[model samples]
Target: MNSSWNPTHGWEDLVSAALVGTDRRPLPSGAATPEAELFDHAALLTVRARAGQTPREGRPLEAAPQERQPEVSRAAGDRLARILGGERPRLLTEWLQAAAARGHRLSPHLLPELLDQAARDRSIRPHLGVLAGARGRWLAGLNPAWGFLLEEVTAPGAAHETWELGTSGDRKAHLGAVRAADPARARHLLEETWEKETPQDRAAFLEILADGLSLDDEPFLENALDDRRREVRHEAADLLTRLPGSRLALRMAERAAACLHTENGELHIAPPLACDAAMERDGVRAKPPRGTGERSWWLQQIVARAPLEIWPRLFGRPPGELVRMKIPDWGREVMAGWVRATVLQGDPEWARVLFAWDPLADLLAVLPRKDREDVAAGFVRRHGLDGQLIMVLGGAAAPWGPDLALAVLEKILQVSGTQPWNLSELSRLAGERIDPALYGMAERLSPEPPIQEVAALLRFRDDMLKELQ
Candidate 1:
């Protein structure tokens, strides 16, 4: 209240009094300031200072790099908002793929949100780089949360430094980038530090080999089979299996050939007597899972890792013919291993044959999408409505064609009343994957509880798809 009182002179004293409590350390007493008046004045000044505060002007942000593509339409932007808001996140990958195919860039305002989304869901990151455009990459450089994106845009020289001196994640990103550019070099880089890396790090680095997998990588992978770590051995075996001509596959094929043969036009299989040291060295685990016979477990591993080409040559029959032949109980176990191998190797022709023998979900997914749908359609028609058919259909890609859609609808209508529980999950899958064009067909279903719920979900999905479009 004094005309010439400077608040700065007693500011420290005032803060100390406030910290220790004015009861213990009474407010500074002076001619112009009584304790009661001092408290009131301090309160008034605090309120005034807070109310009068203004944000300091920051330096202007640098201009964003020029975007090559035009911004997406307002409708498309709105669709992205809905997708990011979790209305139908499952369709995000499809939407991103579609948008990237159309050569449209996301709106500038959405770049941060999209990058944040990519950070949380890494599956979308590969597609996001292109769709996010120049502005997104520019924004990513300024934010640590989004720094992963910068790896994609960084210069080759700078990326090399990041790979050499940065954290494990940064190094992995650099390795991925290098692998995409020159696969052999990536392998060389990893090999340089292979001995120094921990077992877990070694296993993780081995995964990068999958990116540029080829017969050229076979020798390194074959040597990795003898790694001290079981995981490294398993990973090496998995990669080697992908290369039919790899030495490991040849050994497996030879082992499988010795165990399996056709006798008098019927298949016969002799399970391995023991999991020998050689088999274990090649990545076969010595211990069987609980309740599994040791020989059967060993046989499964041998057959599953053997190259698909081995069967037709060894049995002198095409895959389709061999799969249909009658097999002894032990032979069935061997065939199951072959089926698993088909899925693991992604041998579509073998998968197609095995699916015909037994329409398993894993085999179905391995076949080409069109072949998968056709096979599923046939199975649905032959077996009538069942859980297996629903599973195959559920795993198939979305926007189910007219024939598959109608087949599914007919099957749903046929069994809706009897299998309510199965139909509940089937209906949900139908909503997610069925073509919106089949709305009228879905609407025509009888108003039973199952059909009613499915119809509602279909309508909601239709709306969600339309918004995304």
Candidate 2:
């Protein structure tokens, strides 16, 4: 090639020669053919183009903030690395909770991966904040993808700043923080911006209000029943219904009393004939979804939103007595409404009676943890491992105590012979929730692969928990 076939000039000539025929634009000297010469020069110019750029200075990065909380034990850190590396990753949440409870910080090198994992699985976000420490906060400050870590762990003062100026998610997080500290203050903050916020935001803020709900919040929520947005009105009514003394609750009680009453040891029913303006204003829908009769829908809503206390008073009997007694005509609708009310009111006595009437997972959630385990154990002993069983187990909190754990193990062994396929979800829950001390017992339960898998996870979790301790 010619001496002028340098990095800059050489690229220009190669492009011109290749585009227009070499006959019109003569090839630079070197190779025998124009094609050969063009290829050789192009290769040379590509390398020169890539390697010839002048380097520029980069801004200095600040060091990560100092962590006040001490790091987790070396063994615990190694286990965390393994969990993040994808060995029984579901245990990551357990590990995070354990570490946080121990008042330890996460190893700095592991923050990025854990943060990434948390971004995908939001259930872990709550545990991640305290354990992540100052360094994790620093990393979150640098990377917008992990910004949720900052929001989850923001200080009370910083929360107010975020509420004043941050994005929608940030504002919500701020409001949650304020609500936890002072429900009244949070309500006032929302009230100040009530008119300025969008309908969606109004609904979201109302949901936050549910955490520290009181009779004090009844007035604000009652007014919200007239919101232009359906969702905002719905949320307001839900909050009101939970407060049995609220005016909306009293109205619902009166409406429900009109529809449902008992006479001569048999329950009578009178479903609403029409959806009037008064009923609609109290947050009842004018229309029903497919397959549900409009009158039945109205009756269900009225019963569900009415105070649970109304039942015992009307029947002159305890919840246990009422739950066992069948509704003669509207059995499905009335029982379903009572279940909804039981959940909303969070009455343990009602939940216990309801669970006995029908072993439901939603009702299971309302029971205390010990009671939950006892109820689940009783159900497992009677019922076979099935979809509903899985849901029931899910409602109870983990490290499911010895009675429930052994009951589940016995069921696993029993089912292994006849219906092994059903063991998939049951075995997984057993491994995740069973107390780790039972690893040996679990291992010796059966030779089935599913049984063995549960044993292995139990052992792994045993070691994991010890390392944290």
Candidate 3:
């Protein structure tokens, strides 16, 4: 009865008996289970053994997925090119795999035209990262195909994106070496080509800095704070303020301190007002009016660009006073706009302060869930839905209806759970209100899970039959 068992599980006694007659001799390394007995005598590679399997514990529910970048970009780009160049469809995928093995960068000029041709042949498509992410130039945003790369690189697996760094004798060790202190170098590299890069490429390249902001990039970024292109200036300034020590912080603080005061034992500065000469020279430009004051949208942008550190100094008092200061009645919308800006910049110390303001709190408290849903939904559609959707789910799902979440799930899950970073984000975003159905789909789609068909995912299909009763 050859068997497998842990050597520590009283296997010696069983082995002695088996050797005498039952032939159940345990391997020196393993228990006396029938398989282990065979392993003992069969010159098996039963190196290490555990006495028992660990029991399973439940994990949280569904999270919208985050897509991978780069690796999938390489894969899809190569495949689409091969198909466009007239290879068989199957051969295109094979060639793509081969190209990925060889480590090739898709020629930016060739990728789109190739994708267009492949589309005509019906062999390649949106699946091609090189095409989907190519905003006619540099790849911006996550390609649904490659979204798993960062997740895989950052954390090992707890979710589907899990991968071993240097197994299988691949080139991962070299890749790891290059990525060892990647954050700083990569930002500099972007700065190197910032001027020559197209507007789309500029946006794409600048966004990468956001993923891993470093103070080391501050000098170059500060130069960009006043860039001719508004988009470049906006994103660059935003990234810099993320680092608390930058000059913008001190400047913003100066402005904020100047704004507030308690005159004769009462508050003075108006809470919201037009960005008069004092405000503009100070960096608060009343612009882009969506209402009575400058456009709420423009006010949001300028406030977001002005460092939160400025508020205390600009007001000549603390945030509590700033919140209490009077404003042109219409300024309520403008300040609320500023509060929303703080959320995107995501500086907690500042957001917490703004978050606590009674006026800001009141607006959020009474705001319609539908309005928030619509607003955020607009962002999701504009940006890639995968990562953003996960963020929303982690928060109050609210009365926005299950359909919004379901749509986000259906759209984003197609690329979920393949990478490590995405998995970590997924876990964070789903929090406790995870949707079980989405979780099941994630499991089934897991790279390690057995392939299974999911009936509910009819999102990507082009053909649907409607039966009218």
Model 2 poorest ten-residue lDDT run:
48-57
Candidate closest to the true structure, highest lDDT? 2
In candidate 2, stretches whose alpha carbon ends up further than 4 angstroms from where it belongs are 1-63, 100-104, 131-135, 154-213, 224-232, 263-265, 276-281, 285-287, 317-329, 437-452
Please, what is the TM-score per model?
0.64, 0.74, 0.39
Q: Residues 328-358, candidate 3: write the lDDT tens digits.
A: 4434554664575465456444444554452
Candidate 1 overall lDDT versus native: 0.75
Superposing all C-alpha atoms, what RMSD in Å does each candidate have to the true structure?
A: 9.2, 7.8, 24.9
RMSD in angstroms between candidate 2 and the native structure over all alpha carbons: 7.8
lDDT of 2 by residue, 8-46 (tens): 446677788889978788765565776776777787776
Model 3's lDDT to the true fold?
0.43
Clashing pairs in 1: none
